[model samples]
Target chain A: MSHGRPVRRRGRPASAERNAGEPATRDRILGSARTEFAERGYDKASIRAIARGAGVDSALVHHYFGTKEQVFAAAVQGAFAPAMGIPDLLLSGDREEWGERLVGYIFKIWEDAVTRDPLLAIMRSAVSNETAAAIFRGLISRNLLERVSAGLDRPDAALRVELALAQLVGTAMLRYVIKVEPIASAPAEELIPRLAPVVQRHLTG
Target chain B: MSHGRPVRRRGRPASAERNAGEPATRDRILGSARTEFAERGYDKASIRAIARGAGVDSALVHHYFGTKEQVFAAAVQGAFAPAMGIPDLLLSGDREEWGERLVGYIFKIWEDAVTRDPLLAIMRSAVSNETAAAIFRGLISRNLLERVSAGLDRPDAALRVELALAQLVGTAMLRYVIKVEPIASAPAEELIPRLAPVVQRHLTG
Candidate 1:
């Protein structure tokens, strides 16, 4: 439930004496992985550097997350953790207001540096590198889009989810990463109203 | 206008004996610049490499486009050249069909590698480098969005133009650059209908 830390999944033995500090160490490795990926990008970043950043041995990092790609994938999963609840949010809310809710939640994530930085890192890597792109693609499709699509009864639900996401993702690229104006400088409140309907239409209309 | 080649403007003198073949040389430099930026990204791309790519001297690259940023700007302009007429396209169409027209036209450009490659290069650079991002922002704002915004009578026309663009840009990032499936493999024909309405709402609604 921690905002930026990797979520420790259930069913792992909780009381093993040797595993006592495993979660913290694992979280630290993941944090280091994010920083490495963010600063060096996917192609240039290395597992050794991520371990060094975490102040752990390379063996420990490898022990926890198998390959460099797996490390990157874990980092991605952590970065996306906060937003993972979106499907639940959508399912719980009135369908009519889903657009406003989706836009509002995503913008909030983007507006905050803690959450935004990792997502931006993931995007920068995905755009320029094939391996990273595939990782991102697989994760978003499996974790994010499919969940949202499952909530929709329509046959084209998956495609519709992507179109709506494309709207938000494009807005984020302009506003945060590329920082284009007037999209970049405009207040989030100003944008939410204008963008909500478009997202709503893509999802429900 | 060549699809991937930089468009030479008319103001430059045509008959100078020393300037014979100037347009070809200039276009060559721009072509080289696009490849360099695309291959190395904005930060690592160099004038020396670009010049070498074009089989010209670095000085010649400097003479044509002053700084790395300037070279990048020219490349951005050229890459965007095909889409530059979008304002006219939007203006001439039955206002109601502008969404379909705009989406259809952009997808055509993206579907073709010649036009899409330079754009992909420009986007890669822009997302990773601040200087590249600014140059891209300035050019898109001045050359593309401003022209589109000018045609609309609404006070919020500029914002609307950007939001609509955000949708397409994001979709392009997902479908082309990142190659996310469902959206990526989905035929343009299938996507255009679903997307055009969202764009129409942003632009005219």
Candidate 2:
């Protein structure tokens, strides 16, 4: 149960460091890597850099995760882990107000203290770094895009998925990455209603 | 990311993506740099490669731009230069259906073969590639953002600027980069009304 070392789950996916437990060294390393990459980008993101942020030895980073790219992938997957339930939360109900609900949900997550900083870091890294962006693209396309698109009945369901993504991600980018005011600080509840219909149009409307 | 498009500006900034109005070699080199840089990104985009694409000598790229960073800086500024007023178009008066108007205007830009493709490459590059992203950030912060944020009467004018940008950029990304179907192929006229209001709200509302 020592947090210094984390055990990887056997027979699990071989991607970013295996999430041994909450706050395990692996998670810690990934978290630090997320911040470093966001701030500096891929070419500048190094094992030593991540380790320094994580307060661990550079060798430990290698031992836990094979490469910086692998670490990046892990960070990205972690970023959206909070919203993995979006499709389920969304599809559980009828088609009405889906957009409002979705936009609100993203805004809420973006506002959460625990998730906000790291998630924004992942987002910036995803766009600002090569390996990180690829990781983000894959993670998003496979996880959110596919699952959400699957729930839509529109002839252009796939297109809708992309639109919805643009709406939500664009909002997040402005609100978080760029730190635009108002939208960044406006109550999440206020945002949800205004933003949801937009999301709904992309989803079911 | 896919290297298929053309170019853009402020009040409309003069761009390197097209020599449409002029056929000068300098213009052609700038245009070629835009495509090559946009497609392959700053790192992968070599002087030699740009020369090939532009049908010029590698020495010429070095001659005009000086170095890759200078070349990248030039390409970015030329591609995303400031343009005339869209908000002016939207903020005409009483702007009840502003959202519809705003969305449509932005969409029109992305739908045209002459403009959409190079923008597609620049945007994708800005997010996923380091040097290009830096160039994009500079272009946006320097030229586009200030103009967009100007003249807003909202309590959160800056936030509105970010949101407005998010809306426009998001629409473009989904429609062009991701090629999200109907949004991509949909008639520009058809898509504008749906989008303008959201943009309108971000602006004057």
Candidate 3:
């Protein structure tokens, strides 16, 4: 399958005659932006630098992603798209194992460098910038908490979901972001069993 | 309480002629560092700025606190002193009620402006800077987790303690820092009961 083209590439090279550029220029810009944002953070990150990193002109970066905020939005969308599937994951399977599955799925991502690095960058940016934090908040709330709550019949389901998430997010912040010992070095399998019940209790208890 | 002092001011100005400045100049520098670190984070925060914030010269700051790192160490000790009381609180309470007490104490600090503001600043700083994060991690591990684990009879106790903390810290990060809906707006009383069980399970289950 062709990549980086969220839109159909049906019309062959109609524009390619004029634009004879790489196939996934947008993806390249995205890749560069991710590196820039992760390294420099939102406030210090620059479009010029991102374009340079992507081996493109600054104008192209602007044309493709518009403002830095828009670029950040796109980056967030790409990074968090899989996490949006969390509600479905939580909804399926026995309700009894939802907590374990939820935590399990999260650690799976955290353990993988490709996914974890961008996430850590976003998390660090959010801590420093209100705009970044707002984006993080909106994504988590709309995609995960709200979706998960919709499946529950209870009134406090939203709060419960957040509490459960707090556990996971907090652990991630400590273990991954802060590199806190024990938790940081402990095997994920050991933690999964120990922490899953706490998550489960949040969901059902 | 003599404000800003970690030590007592005794002797009725025995050496007032030679050292007439306030008795707690050291404490004052520490207080200023906390504000600086919290507001600007570790990288951006400066010794001169912290000194100015405390109404002292840079030399005085250096004289009293040594390196910026030392200032941060002192600031951490001061800022985290209250939280260090957690083990005592956890140990004294009915083991079952420890969760409730733990959550209650945390919410008390998070809800209070005097404490919450500085703590929030420190947390935000810690998220972005490795030095700040290291200070935070060291304090939690040495003061809270290890101390609490010492009280526990069970194995994996340290991991359990970290998990319980993850729940509390994550909730605070989202509710107080990220300010997500429902959990952000929900009364602490409401959250405490719901979150207590999750913490309990991490500690005991």
Real contacts retained, model 2: 0.31
Give the candidate order by descending lDDT.
1, 3, 2
Using Cα atoms with residue i matched to residue i, what is each candidate's TM-score against the true structure? 0.86, 0.65, 0.86
lDDT of 2 at A78: 82
Q: Compute the DockQ of candidate 3.
A: 0.60
Indicate the worst ten consecutive residues by lDDT in candidate 1 chain B: B9-18
Candidate 1 docking category?
medium
Instruction: Kindly report which residue stretches of model 2 are placed more than 4 angstroms away from their true locations once superposed.
Output: A1-23, B1-82, B91-101, B111-164, B173-205
lDDT of 1 by residue, B29-126 (tens): 89899988866777778999999999988887776678998899989999989988798999886989989999999999999999998898899889
Best-performing candidate as measured by DockQ: 1
**Candidate achieving the largest lDDT:** 1
How much does each candidate deviate from the true structure in C-alpha RMSD? 6.2, 8.5, 5.4
TM-score of chain A of each: 0.87, 0.84, 0.87
Error of 2 at A25 (Å): 0.8
DockQ of 2: 0.22
Per-residue lDDT tens digits of candidate 1, residues A1-205? Answer: 3589556554433456325546778889988988877666677789999999999888878877889999998888888887898888887869999999989998889899989988888888787678888988988888878888888878888888888889999999988987877888999999999989888899999
What are the lDDT scores of the predictions, listed in order?
0.85, 0.65, 0.81
